[model samples]
Target: MTAPVAFPVVTISDDLALATACARWRTCPAIALDTEFERVRTFWPKLALIQLCDGEYVALIDPLTISNWTPFAELLRDPNVVKVMHAAGEDLEAFLGGCGEVPAPLFDTQTALALIGKGVSLGYGAAVQLYFGITLAKDMARTDWLMRPLSDDQLRYAVADVTYLLPIWQDCAQALQQRQLADWHREDSEFAARRLQQQEPAEFLYRKLKAAFVLRGQQLAVARELCAWRETEARNHNIPRGHLLKDESLLLVAQKMPRNWPALSVLETLHPRALRVHGQAILNAVERGLNCPQAQWPAPVRRLLDVPNGKAAQDAMVAAVAAFASTRGIPAELVFSRRVLENLLLAIVDGQPYPPPMWQGWRRAAVQSALASELTSFGIALPDWW
Candidate 1:
């Protein structure tokens, strides 16, 4: 094991200190960034701490003390400086919640690694070990960042996140350039940053449920209303959705369209406490759904298996995509995950337009060229623009 290097750690609890750091950060071409937050029980992550490194300086900014996040948020939005992070999905969410803005012109080291064929979804610690042969301790990973008076171990863990990130990003950036994958990495990293910051509309939330396809017409409308209500309540209470009402219970209520308290009370999956408290609200949601116009009801969702030849076509397309990615030394999922491909397949089968973003830029050529023969065999033709 390599001896640990000591980087200066400065804590910024006040606005001036943070502003000073931001001034320095503005001059840098790129900076490593990471966040520590508590999200186990809450719908929104409680921002606890922010860490940053720019090859020379390391700073731990206490989010609890800083009232003004403008400086930091501006730095994140700066077009000149690239914000670097590893596996930045959750961190992007944290930034949106904590700083009111996500980093633009982002460089995600994990995505870069996948582009360079290092590994898919390699974690921060593993990447540190891979690039620098330093095995980081995991003891402080689960420490409470919201607590005042953080322990030395906790501080070390937070600092270490950004400490090694800049170097890993440099290596990945170099490798991406060598492989002519810089454009691909940039597209993916920016997409990831934008994607995570988006909030899924509550009315459309039921579409995300796996069992939603089983319901149709009015039942689907009821499910959508219940889902939207649950989403709103969860956010208002700042509690996890399942903590209030489990999905199964919601689905059952939608399916039953229970009218009276006794009817709603019969669902075994519905918790006793929830029934006692939100029973009327749930019933009201059901009433609203039932009164909804038939034209406004959500269209029935068909199971993939219900579609003729859907299974075989999905399987063949998956194999073709995998084979195409392998030949180019790219992670297949990076192009399109199995779940995404399934959705795309379903959309096509329904005569809907292909998702515009997925078929743009480098991905368009990759997918079209890769699946040309397979698509032809299936009697499917991609749009000429693709």
Candidate 2:
């Protein structure tokens, strides 16, 4: 049986209450922060509530009632105050959308756990249970946070987010200090926070589409144009990009380079709503792509599995990273993910920059030697700087 714990909940509704809470929080050296939002059908997350705890004080600040964010924004920008969170990616997004800024000097418990060799992708509940032997109820996870007058269970769940986080932050900070990886955690947390706020340029977005590797030359250009148009349309309407047109349908259209409605109608994956709403716009994008100069065409993206000897090199690097991580007490996934290795391989094949930031900083000392040895064995030479 799980032991019941007391959480003194205080609701900050108006601007004055929120400002007062921020004033108190600014004095604390470290505080736990979390946000509840809804984003199921929209391009951006809808900010619902902000939860905060500083060991002794717990408060839920309702964004619906607060207008003046001057005090809270100052608290976020305060250098002395360290904001701690768990799996802060989406929460960071919520903060950016809500207040046009994100917390710096962030200490993400999930990232800290991975650096300590515990695990990557450790959810808050798992971390709490792992460290405190407490199983939290997740029944309120899917509740409508934007609704007026939230239920008791909803408010309790919100408080619980930051309540256990305070202790988890303490434990994680201690572990990081003991392992001498506090700087690494700080660097990664800042990078992740910044990355969450970045909007990838639409022109380059097609490179991330599924099966983009299959399209080349004019076909690739078409895919790029189509994706760029979809991105603009989605953002303009505040709907999901996928809801406008699925990737497979876009890819199919790109492959065929359809010029007319009849030609586009043959694509079974293209939804009827898209055809009725934006059919001519899609054809115009296709025409523009067809008329694009040869020099403007995007190069085909190559996957390691599709390229000769690429898979072997990737496997060697993966093994090297795993072996190095095992000895250094760092999670291998944290050291280098599959996507990172793929990007590294493409850079090497294209004779582009040898080492991206993934191979720099603390990671350079951890896995560089082993990875370099693997590449040399495969007859690949690193850039002079590498």
The most accurate candidate by TM-score is 2
TM-score of each prediction: 0.89, 0.90
Clash pairs for candidate 1:
none
Which candidate tops lDDT?
2
**What lDDT, from 0 to 1, does candidate 1 have?**
0.82
lDDT of 1 at 289: 93
TM-score of 2: 0.90
Candidate 2 off by > 4 Å? 1-5, 235-237, 265-268, 350-360, 381-386
Clashes of 2: 0
Candidate 1 structure quality by residue, lDDT tens digits, 1-386: 24236678888999999998899999999999999999988887888999998887689999999999999999999999999999888888888877889898899998898888878889888888887888899988788889999998899889989988877777788889999999888888777776676556677777777788878889988998899888899878887888777888888888999988888887767778878888898999999899999998887666788777777777877887898788888988888777777776665554443353465567767777656666557776555443
What lDDT does the true structure give each of the candidates?
A: 0.82, 0.84
- Model 2 Cα lDDT, one tens digit per residue, 293-324: 99988877777776668889999888988898
